[model samples]
Target chain A: MNPLSVVVRTICDIFTWFIGIFGIYIIIHGHMTPGGGFQGGAVVATMMAFLLVSHGGKKTLSFAKPGLYTAMETIGLLVFIGAGLFGITTTFFFNFLAGQGGVFGATVPIGPNSGVLNSAGTISIMNMAVGLEVIGGLSLIILYMFKGIRLFDNAAESGETGHDR
Target chain B: MKKRVLFMIAILVVAGTFWGALDNIHPFGDVPVAPMDDYYIENAQQERSVNNVVTAVVFDYRGFDTLGEAAVLFTAVCSVLALFRKGREGQ
Candidate 1:
């Protein structure tokens, strides 16, 4: 699990934070922008992959836990479901909060205009939820693949060849 | 040779289908005449108070589909974890 070359690690260290911030902005402003939860989440996950690839498996694994990612994924799904259930008085996934004049409930004009952050009822919540879920899912996938590669490398080093075990 | 011919025929069929589909598809930068699209565009701002009609459609109007998508992603994560759990434990 040797660290990557000095240049790559340095660049990753410098740029990962900005990448993460951009992704969060995309997710949070999804209701008013073109990019939504999934796209932004993928961007953040890509940043994670970049860091993992640059830092090596052992260090990356030590920095983050698979359990934490699984928990995040679960929480995201639960939040999404809960938000949907909050609208169940009218329908399964009603926009109960829209036009109610509160947090994430401001009404917008009928035509094109500047977007408001505190608008769009459940959409914003769902965006954040989906973003979290996607980030967790994609990062976990990359981590698992890296772990498998590391395991196979170890097995080979130990001279334990073949698929018997 | 038989396999090669079959492969060529398959490629030809797929290409022809794509070509036909592309021919029928709306031209670039042209909006399709969909009442649902018009309805969403006209009503999303008033109904959902969101500027992005796409988000309104996805997270509000068609939330069940999003739930299904989330379920699919969760299933994938579960499968990946199940496959790699033993290796992780061994370490």
Candidate 2:
């Protein structure tokens, strides 16, 4: 696939990093604010789509390996599940780390106030985990679709049926 | 002519049902009773120490649901990857 004109590429290059940063901010601030992992991850994945569309498949593929995405997703799932299992001695998905005065273990005041960053223990960790998984999964979907379309183009050019033999 | 009449009837039926359902729905933001909401609002800060009640509900009170959502997304990715496997292997 041919990439878009230089103007679009320039815009994408300049703005994609900002989008990624905003998405990370949203994921991290999930327990304190509204947006969470899924929404933030979708935002980041939108940046990936912008890159893919402007740069074309070959350039995008050169930077983004599907294997790496798979690894990220796997790691995210493992971490999320591991975090959940940590509290199994009490109960499944117990909030053991809350109010413990450790990292991510500060007791929130019982009324409305400006929330602390390091307050919600396991919830914050899960947010990051889900964020990673969503970023990897969404990017992989778009990448796979683009690659599949290109494969059809290649088969057609080489005078072979794109369908299975 | 027959098809047009049938289509009109179908549209009317769908619109009427939607209107009826909308009429029955609680007015705007006014709920009759929200015991669960009150409970979560009162307890979430102490139980989870999170300012965002929605996040507390999602990641703590209803964590298994989030896990299921993650599984669904994983399954979708796996399906898409499987469909495109031939393309990768042929290269």
Candidate 3:
């Protein structure tokens, strides 16, 4: 079993929620504000990292395998490109799905000016697509770093030697 | 403890939400019927071959960049193939 206490786990959970929510906010209001897809996605991924660090693979990573991040990033990139290809027929970059307000104006319409789910334009769709890819890709990178550290720690515990004079 | 951190983040999010709501430029707008930029018109006229300004800029104005990117990807793939081939041959 892991050695961390309840206090650490609780603290980590709180931080994770904050960072994740904040990052999403930035991504949504990218055009009107300074933050955008890439920035916000990175912020969101950091939440997962926090979870992994404090709670170990059991709590934060039990839902996934080590290669899950890699698969997510690959699929996310493909999805992003698929969205970009829509520009060919529409208006050179006209977001076919950016109907009005949020991610799902049609699916989750807000009655008048679309809803929060409706994406605004091609850029917004592109923003979201890129955001997912960015989050997946960078999250994997962080995971790799920590995994490497864990490997080194295991080696130290085993009293493995590393000498090359 | 974790509660404090969560509270801090919650505070940040609430503050940010208020900030976003208060300083929104286009709080409400209809479907865009026209181009949002004038550069598209100018570029379309300057480069008349393609009808789509976005395509023209991507494929024409920055064709060289695309070519270089393609070349880099090709080279990386070739190197990876070579590395794998050598290991297989040794066995």
Candidate 4:
């Protein structure tokens, strides 16, 4: 029974890692391709849920930090919204600001039709915001779920068995 | 047992085939199917201030979706609260 459980858990881990990678791939290539922030974020969140279920509570969620996740989500959204307001002069949501151009760790040509994946403008910044918000928010949700389940189970065992804390 | 597995596989195959067919059709392509044109990008650009059109669509344009997502978080919190609340009541 133990061995079978281990095998099932291993398979689940592999599937979850695949989900995480696919989610990230969609987010990063959001500019050139279609997949962007919200879709990729949900994917990552589901992957986190998978991880929490496969691994024990301590291993998967002991590090659950609500404050940090909240901060990241708030900051990421602020940045995303700020980008839009800063571009208020030209267009309502023109993303063609400093964040709009750069190559792999290098700046883009600082002109029109610069490099494809350069960190210019609205797309990259927004994707980043989505990434941060989704990863933190989703993980927190799943971690809290596990915490609730564990608490309920423990309480039930204690109450039913007439045990003292 | 074998019949059950085969039946499940048959259903999966039909579903997968339907998905592949839709993939060819490309339902989300830039066009109107029934009444409204593919207002996805237009709608997105109109609402949000974000540069990435998609982000605007999710965060600003469709603020309700974000709210619903927040509700999901709240639901999870409520579940956790239930466990603790019940225990405290007993004690």
Candidate 5:
């Protein structure tokens, strides 16, 4: 695929990081805000799509390692499941850390008030985990779909010669 | 002509079902009484220490569902990777 015009590439360079920041914000603030892991991760994955659109397949594919995304997806899933398994003694997916006065364990006053970041315990952890998984998963899907297109083109070319034989 | 009549009957049946269902549906924004919803709203913050009741429900009260959703996404990615792995060796 051909790269877009220089202006689009330049704009992509400037705005990609901003898109990343916004996605991270939404993921982290899942407990206090409207957006959550999946929503935020989809937003972050848009950054990869944006990059692909501006930079074209060859440059973007070379830059992004499949191994890294696989690792991220695996790690995210493991951590999410680990968080759930850790509370098995109490109950599956128990809020054992809530009000425990540790990381993500601070208790908030009941009723309306300002939101607390260092609260919501495993919920926050799960949010981040799911966010990571989604980022990896969606980006991988986009990358592979692009690669598939090229693969189809190559296969078609080969199949034509084979048919002639 | 018979086929067209059958199609019309099918369409009318579907539309009538939808119309009957709409009559039974609760008005928008006026939620029906649900004890579980009430419990979550009244006690989610106190019980889970999360200001967002929806988050509490998703990640705490009904976390198993979220786990299943995550698993579904993982399987999708895996399938995509597997499908595209054939041409990867030469690249």
Candidate 6:
């Protein structure tokens, strides 16, 4: 696909980092806020789509490696499963770190108040894991779909020339 | 004429079902009594140490479902990759 106009590309360059930052904020604050991993990851994945539209498939694909995303997807799933497994002595998916007074283990007041980022234990860990998984999954889907389109275009061109030969 | 009549009937069935369902709907902002929801609201923060009860429920209490959901997404990504894989050249 061809790149968009210079104006659109310029705007995309200015705003793409903001989109990524916002998505990471949502993922990081999932346990304390409205949005969580799935939602935030989906928001972050839009960066891939946005780049593909503004910069074109060739540049986007070259810049973003499939291997990196594949690794991210695998690692996220492993971490999520590992988090669940760690609490198996009590019960699967237990909040073992909550109230334990450490990273992601701070206790919040029993009633309504401002949220604590250091709270939420395995929930926060799982949120980050799922967020990573979603970012990799959705971006891979978009990239592969674009590649498929290019393959189809090549096949059509080859078929057209075959008729002349 | 027959196809149009069938389409009209189908639309009426869907609309009637929706209209009937609306009558049973509770008033806005008035939630039905649910012991499970009450338990989560009351205890999630204390147990999970998370201010967001919804997140606590999703990522903690009902985490098995989220695991399944993640697996589903992984499978979908795998399938897309397999389908779009480049064919061997000079084969």
Question: What's the CA error at residue A88 for candidate 5, in Å?
Answer: 0.6
Alpha carbon deviation, residue A157, candidate 5 (Å): 11
Which residue segments of model 2 deviate by more than 4 Å?
A150-152, A155-165, B1-29, B87-91
lDDT of 1 by residue, A59-159 (tens): 78778877888888999999999999999999988988898988888888778788999899889989999999999999999888777675446754785
Provide i-RMS per model in Å: 0.9, 0.8, 11.1, 6.8, 0.7, 0.6
TM-score of each: 0.83, 0.85, 0.50, 0.56, 0.88, 0.85
Which residue pairs collide, candidate 6?
A: none
Answer with 4 or 5, whichever has the higher DockQ.
5
How do the residues A99-142 of candidate 5 rate in per-residue lDDT, one tens digit apiece?
A: 88888899999889888999999999999999999999999999
Error of 1 at B67 (Å): 1.0
lDDT, each prediction: 0.86, 0.88, 0.53, 0.58, 0.89, 0.90
What's candidate 6's DockQ score?
A: 0.76
User: How would the candidate models be sorted by lDDT, starting from the highest?
Assistant: 6, 5, 2, 1, 4, 3
List candidate 4 stretches off by more than 4 Å. A1-4, A98-115, A150-165, B1-91
Over the stretch B1-91, how does candidate 3's per-residue lDDT look in tens digits?
A: 9999999999999999999888975536654555634655454323222233453344334434433443453344335434433233336
Model 5 chain A weakest lDDT span, ten residues long: A156-165
Interface RMSD (Å) of model 6? Answer: 0.6
TM-score of chain A of each: 0.89, 0.90, 0.67, 0.71, 0.90, 0.91
lDDT of 2 by residue, A1-165 (tens): 657789888999999999999999999999998899899999998987898778776688789888888998888888888888899998888888998988899998889899999999999999999999999999999888877785545853786443322
Off by over 4 Å in 6: A151-165, B1-30, B88-91
Pairs in steric clash, model 4:
A95-A121, A95-A122, A99-A120, A99-A121, A100-A120, A100-A121, A101-A120, A102-A108, A102-A118
Residues B1-91, candidate 1: write the lDDT tens digits.
9999999999999999999999998889987789988889889998889999999988899999989988999999889988866444546
Report how far residue B24 has shifted in candidate 2, in Å.
5.7
Least accurate stretch of 10 residues (summed lDDT) in model 1 chain A?
A: A156-165
